[model samples]
Target chain A: MLPRRLTRPRITLGSPVQLLLLAASFALAAYAGVRLLADDWFGVALWFVGLALLHDLVLLPLYTIADRAIVGGLGAVRRREWTPYVRVPAALSGLLLLVWFPLISGRVDRRYRTATGLQADVFLARWLLVTAVLFGGSALLLALRVRRAAQHRPPAAR
Target chain B: MRDPDAPRLPSSPGFWRSPLRGPWLTSVLGLVLLVGITVLFVTGLVSYAAYNPNLSPVNDKTPDKGILGFYLFAWPTSPHWLYRLNQGVHVTLGITMIPVLLAKLWSVVPRLFALPPARSLAHAVERISLVLLVGGALFEFVTGVLNVQLDYVFPGSFYPLHFYGAWVFFAAFVVHALLKMPTVLRNVRHLREEKNDLVSPRPAEPTVSRRGALGFTGGASLLLFATTAGQNFDGPLRRTALLAPHGGVDPGSGPNGFQINKTAVYAGIDAAETGEDVWRLVVTGRTGTVRLSRTQLAELPQHSGALPIACVEGWSTSDQWWRGVRLRDLAALVGHDDDPPDVFVESLQRRGAFRSAALRANQVADPRSLLALHVNGEELSSDHGYPARIIVPAAPGVLNTKWVTRMTFRGL
Candidate 1:
């Protein structure tokens, strides 16, 4: 278990706070489905369907994969791996999802730029390059550190 | 692979060089699947426009010509395995791909912000594409969520934003693809040169095994599949079961939000039973030839899918379908699937100035696209293309051809 201070920042599954929030949200959605907003059924329906997509389609899988990889495979590489590693996951994931907002909102002409305006394949290629450079740069730095450590070894008393 | 004895590296000092761990793999895979699935929808729209020239912006004004396009655009059909399959790809890919994409972005944040692209057109365009990709991903997730609950909530209208935003979605992916092309090729080349870390191991914590995580992922993904697939089990709710459900413009049979053009020219020739000699579909295009009898047609292998006919005008339906031949498969049967890039379909009507408004190959290649012969359970209805009709999911209605007599395959 992580210390309280650090754990405060991290979201844990099945925690009391998380469970309470989840329970409250579901209760609200159910209530709305049955009682509060029966007439405006379309919106309510959209809300529920949208909720499933948000969680099942995107969030959970992302986090699950991240948690498993970061926590399991490379956890032993650095004592402080959590901080920097999570930073990458946190920022990029948040940003990527954010940018897709207008289109996902189902507002095509009003919000999203038309397809002719944006060449999508090109964008993906550049994004990959950016990611590669980041990982590549990190590896280089680590190799440099290892080399310096070997060179600085003090002579034994022999 | 992991080395139990190796020291654990902290994330703070370096964002790059993280091993392909659970998070990294998940994120990368998620991004790949996410992009690929989104691309499927995008290309679907293009294929729709490509096939039925009536749906073209050039002919948008002539609503009469667009009647066929409308049905092609909006209706859904039965044996909807394609819908389930695409949904499977879309939902599962999004969930898994998002995090990996996130990690990938994180690794490169510094480069993005620092040494910012010069205020040149190239840099500006590049930055803009990135913005679209990031934003598009989020939008896809949220709306996709809304789409799933549509059956329970809205009840009637359950079409995903795929139908409405197809054109724009197409543009977004096109931009992303063009931007990433060079770099992707380079990276892929690099991948070829460097051993896949995914397959091998770095000298770190030996306990870390990608294989283990994969095993778990495989299991969990199966659970996801089972749970999701369970949510939608097809029954006899299709139109075939709705015996004579108000033949006079059955509003329920028509897709949601689609304006029924009550004036469709139902083939005057053989709308009812034709003698066996006339029942056969005639083929006309590049190499002119007419094949007799659907029985001869049925001799070819069949492909079936449960697909929704999505119209740009907003209508869809669910139907189980069994087709004797795919456009590709059919083209090959007539001996053209391999060679000719394009094929044109002809109806029984005489050709006019708009003679070229026929089916094309690009449209059928889409995953949910189909040329159906059966709806509900038995042979297709006379009103609904008795022998053959094209049914493309995510395609506008006009493109789906009813009463397909002949498919001519050629380089044209």
Candidate 2:
């Protein structure tokens, strides 16, 4: 009789569905490659390659370092349950900043105004206010949680 | 010697398991990513198809025949808000996905740097697909965000790069989903059953409950949606959409309220060239070329219709009164106006991606389509394609070619 390992359905190369999906994806990717090559091969390739390098080497490191600082900055409350409250709001604020950096920084102010007839000067102040609110709300929630925990703890445990 | 079955040594905080980071959370966020990306891809494709560019022999020169370019769709004018709905959803959903994407990445980032990197061939394939999915998704979102803001930071043209990138991204996404589906289903089932207190192999203390993590992510997405969705909505919603790129001001606000995609200055159109005496509405059809001055065009039976100008950037104007000569009537002035052959509308502007556009038979046949010379009750403003412009229902903003000077009919 065949051994159990031999009898098992091996998926070292991925299951049938995975294989099919990969094949179809590869076909579409090949079409894209052909199209891009026909257009501007060097420029597109450089942009994509530069993007990968910049993201992995620069952006990823910067965000990772920032995250580590957040975790480490908690001091005695590092072990506390409320740290994620801070982390969530901070991450969200950072995302908004990332998405609207051009507008917030006034880089696109003239262009935006010309195109839409709407001033973009308010973005910076609005973003700052939103960030402040998010953090303030999180701090309040954390404080409330802390108060509730203190109240619930038995005198001996406390 | 190290024992083969020894417990995995605990790693540093950023490199190891945490309560907020686990297969369960990953599965949840991954599901969101899956749904969000699917919607974006489908809607994006619908927008692309609306262009209806005959891709085989893409001709920038002779737009009517022999290799018409990629931007060649006779954008539909019917169901008038078609572009508005598709592009609005496209941009708003794209914005909403930012927080969800960030949370999804945050949940699985440690795994990206997992010890030993990959354990098997299957693992390596999975990782590769993940790279494609993430990279492609990021490229699309980043480019889209930039383009909508009129920021052309990228070197290449926006359309082709974005179009091709989407295909690659969707392909990789399909493969990634296939590889991860089983584990995702298993983890989701476990969560539903409450069979495991923690889904990770290493059960870290519950510093942050899963519910708290999910709530934070959801709240962030909701906040972003609320702030950005106002651009697409009208009236009070616009006031609240403070963060929307083009909120608070309708494109149809003043003397030239219709959204100005490319200004006369931007299109390199000389002010002197657009003057009434200097401008001529040229029509070339089966008979011959005929040049009609602005006075002649004004003399032609002027008709008015209320039409919306929907920009590809996602902001649309309300229906405003537009008056001009019907394109079919103008073709009838020449010959081959019966079958309503394909009409090529050429702009006076010397340069731009949309200097000239080909109007398919359908657009020409639509009586609503006009060479609009007057917007509202006033003569066309220079910024609103003065002298004459093509305004057709259901076409992309660019295809409603502005500053029109010539119309060549390709007899079908």
TM-scores of the candidates in the order shown: 0.33, 0.83
Q: Which stretches of candidate 1 lie over 4 Å from their true place?
A: A1-158, B1-17, B21-35, B42-121, B151-169, B189-223, B230-412
Q: Where does model 2 exceed 4 Å of error? A: A1-17, A37-43, A49-89, A113-120, A132-158, B1-14, B55-76, B115-117, B191-207, B250-255
What digit string (tens of lDDT, one per residue) describes model 1 on residues B51-154?
34443332232233222234454223323334434443444444444444444443333333333343444444445444434444444444554443221223
lDDT of each: 0.42, 0.74
- State each candidate's chain A TM-score: 0.42, 0.73
Model 2 agreement with the true structure over A1-158: per-residue lDDT tens digits: 99899999654654555556666777777666566545667776666656655665577668767765666666455554556777877887887888888888889888777655566688898889889998999889988988998999999994
The per-residue C-alpha lDDT of model 1 at residue B274 equals 40
Q: Cα lDDT of model 1 overall? A: 0.42
Residue B302 local lDDT, model 2: 89
